[model samples]
Target: MSQDTQPAYRRILLKLSGEALLGEHHYGVDPAVLSQVAEEVCELSRRGVEVGIVIGGGNIFRGAGLAEGGVDRVTGDHMGMLATVINALALQDAIERAGRFCRVMSAIRINQVCEDYIRRRAVRHLEKGRVVVFAAGTGNPFFTTDSAASLRAIEINADLMIKATKVDGVYDADPFTQTDARRFDRLTYDDALERRLGVMDTTALVMCRDNELPIRVMNMFAKGDLQRLVMGESVGTLVEGSRQ
Candidate 1:
């Protein structure tokens, strides 16, 4: 589609996992993956689709993983939140280098580094066509970044939440373990919940369901997947309140 063409959705909340930033590595940010992601985001932004990203921290630290190692849950979660900030900063830098103005807003106060998150301010940034990166995961210890994404998407009144995953779409069973696992092109929120599809955390999925928000689960590294989605092409599984 041309840059002047209207995108299928006016605005979107892009949820990225910290693991995705690792690319081929086992830990930390990979420069190549970061560049590719930045380019994809820049393309979408330049084409007039407002973008807000909520990224996870598993690549650096995961509270749940730390807790299993006997670390204090709250302390580990705080560390995880900080890891997310690190990622958000890196992403903001990449976005700027990609030629789009970007803002990093944290749910927790880190006045020295990033702006404190304000819903109105975020909305205004999107209105001005600036990409917004939300960090720190809802400022709560227990909640995952997925919850933050859902909450922010609803607050921003986004057309949909795009969850960039390693898998192409939601499967009826675990794709890695089940050779016969079936992928759904679309499904209702209730069905996803009843079948225990681990597309998103329970809290996040429930929040989206209650608000009637739709979610698209797509492979982040898939070539042109984001563009196809913005252009209304079938790229991944669509989960909504009903089969729309």
Candidate 2:
């Protein structure tokens, strides 16, 4: 393949907020959004980039919000985990429909619905050119899906981790509210933490920093952004160690 068409990374872990699947709706998964995301993923797979995904459950449930409303924190988190599984299944269907082999692997077991997450098996699936979607937030309470994305990316030995968001990249201020907000092209992990950039949770940022894993934050809704990013087109805010 020519340099322009070749993918930059061999394998990647994509972290998507559940709200990304909300589209124009106030709640629930939006079919249009799911289809669009699946098409993007399948396109990457077709280009020989191994893809793994970790999607959040905020659209269906928010554990932290419920805990503040008098529900038990642990119970709420478990419920939130289940919500992720629901999204994984939905996304898996969309990916398959887009003509790619997909798997839904959960941290928590649901034998009849999906495979229990196994590090070796998940890696093997990626090597075989299949997309794996990881659901459930570390199978533990109080851990965000961001943390799970970092953990899984490390475990799978991914070349990069991509955090998909509505915004094009990290900004000095809320881009939607601040018309003049400056979007950062690059940032160090320490810079992100020190400035409280909210690129990901502190734990997730620290994990990537300590492990030397790079993260690319980009707008998922933008046409061809994901494709351009994976093809080494530099379409997002890249966060890594101070070295680069």
- Per-residue lDDT of model 2, residues 1-244, tens digit only: 2535778899999999999999999999999999999999999999999999999999999899899999999999999999999999999999999999999999998989999999999999999999999998799999999999999999999999999999999999999998999999999999999999999999999999999999999999999999889888898899998952
- Judged by lDDT, which candidate is best? 2
How high is each candidate's TM-score?
0.97, 0.98
In model 1, pairs of residues that clash are none
Off by over 4 Å in 1: none
Candidate 1, 183-215: lDDT as tens digits? 999988888888899989889999999999999
* TM match of model 1 to true structure: 0.97
TM-score for candidate 2, please give it: 0.98
lDDT of 1 at 209: 97
